[model samples]
Target: MSFRVFGIDAVSYSTYSRLQKGLHAISMMIIVWLMTSGYFAAYITRIPEVKEAVSAFNVALATLFAPVFVFRMCVSFGKGYADVLRSNDVMRYAAFVVHNLIYITTLIVIVSGFLMVNRDIDVFGLFYIPAVITDPRLHRWFSDSHTLACYGLALLLFMHVAAVIKHHLTGRPVLKGMFF
Candidate 1:
């Protein structure tokens, strides 16, 4: 099935499953929020209370998101890989590379963020996740890794958006395939 808007045939672009689209939308929203809030809390604020609140909220959201993200990775990775391997098109290959990089970096960010916590994680005061690493030095290392991975993920996200815009401008609208 496909969609038509403004005389454009969406099926001629890239069609994703409803499940894929839903997962993509949810993941995108959460990731964008987390990244924005994290950056704001880290760099844009001098108020300790505001920073703490943002950090707590982000931690809870991320903890809940980790499993969902892993599920998304499992669902999307193989299909993306197969598409790239089967296609001789350069654009396909490039898209696959960039998409995989985003996935890998996101995974790193989630893992490192969890590892970097030196204390138990309180999820909206409902549950707690105990810190796995006890060593302060290891925590610092993971914290650094999380920050670096976040920067890399942000760059890749920009490239992904740019590619989507480029495709749309070239008269092939891929957004229709990914959205309702």
Candidate 2:
């Protein structure tokens, strides 16, 4: 569905903002999926097909989401956006904390999968990032970090959704300000 607000015919945000938001949504969904997939990978690592598919998905998601995240971080410093972020400093701070939590969690997830697999893992059999170093300690650390981050992310995401719902139900202009 397209984004619309009040009487404005435009989508929820500008083209760039929409793309950023779309990526945000896609990345979030994929990350959630990857978390579950990681559990499956851990329990069913013996399943060749499950391992291969999960590994490929992990690599592709990492590759796709990284640039989108980088761009979002860059644009976050631009003018005008500050106004939207200022709706409520307390909540805005909470959102910032949540964003960072997601970012760190995302990085750990990618790092874990990359470390767990051999350098030969390829996405779509087209691109690859060969592991430069091998140490079981490093891989295990990444995996454990990824697991912890995912647990924290669950709480962060819950708070974020709750805040959004609060804004919507409170009849505040917060959601509107974000799109404008």
Candidate 3:
């Protein structure tokens, strides 16, 4: 099927924005659940199996979303990076840094997770993502790095949400950009 918006033979900008926001919301919810499980469930639980399950789930979810996020970013921020950097607007420049920080921290978390896995993972029992790290020391390093990167991502996410609320509350209606 073919579609057009305003005589332009392409999807409308609003439709693209909605799709991007939908993907972001879904991905963030998964990531938050996985990240929090590591900090909460892994520690309070007495059973080894439960901790292992959470660990496995985190890695599987992170692996699955990593590429999808990268593609979403590329599509959403076509020239915004360079344009924002060149602009004199302090808010825009700061937003750009925070935005890139989220991406950098996410990639770090994913890569560090891949480096931390010790055994081949059977993702939801559908397919396998093979172990990428073997050495105990290297695995430990990656594990620590993964934990730290997850924290970094979490902080960036909080800031991003607060910023949106701030803009919306201050008569900006930035949230409307995502919906309605």
Candidate 4:
């Protein structure tokens, strides 16, 4: 469960199961793509066509990702909570807090994204999901919530990456634990 990288012993310090690792990898890839493309469409684009395309794609992607994300949440939360409660390390507790915040914000983002939809969700033209809220006012509120939660999730993801880099640079190589 350990290997050498650049002449250093990279030990697998994580006890995550194969299922957890797989789920994490899937969720991470989708979330990162969604967030990056979303920000690009919102802040970097002036073309209406480009913005609409990105928006439509992201909504479809997110709709499909929802169930996988919920499953990931279910698998992760119990183990993480138990580990933090059993550990006396302050860093573990800190990581737990940040991790939970990320999960919560992600949940909010997904839910609000769904609720904010003013029209039916067309998932890659496979099927259509009916709009949950009919009120424009409620849709606007959920849209705002989704935006704020996305920003919060971005910050948390940054901290998460920074922490992993810090660990790796310090010889902990915690990043290796999450990989095969």
Per-candidate Cα lDDT values, in order, are 0.90, 0.64, 0.76, 0.89
Q: Compared with the true structure, what per-residue lDDT tens digits does model 1 show for residues 14-113? A: 5577788889999999999999999999999999999999998999999999999999988886776676798899998998899899999999999999
Question: Model 4 over residues 1-180: C-alpha lDDT tens digits?
Answer: 778754569755768888899999999999999999999998999999999899999999999999999999888868867768889999989999998899899989999988998999899999999888899999999989989999999999999999988887888877666776
Q: Estimate the lDDT of model 4.
A: 0.89
Query: Predicted candidate 4: what Cα RMSD to the true structure?
Result: 1.4
Model 1 scores a TM of: 0.92
Return the lDDT, model 4, position 92: 89
Which stretches of candidate 1 lie above 4 Å from their native place? 1-14
Q: What C-alpha lDDT does candidate 2 achieve relative to the native structure?
A: 0.64
The predicted structure with the larger TM-score, 1 or 2, is: 1
Per-residue lDDT of candidate 3, residues 57-84 (tens digit): 8777777887887777776765466778
The residue pairs that clash in candidate 3, if any, are: none
Q: Model 2 — TM-score against the truth?
A: 0.67
Quote the lDDT for 100 in model 2: 68
Query: Quick one: ranking by lDDT, best first?
Result: 1, 4, 3, 2
TM-score for model 4? 0.94
Q: What stretches of model 4 exceed 4 Å from their correct place?
A: none
For model 2, how big is the CA root-mean-square deviation? 4.9
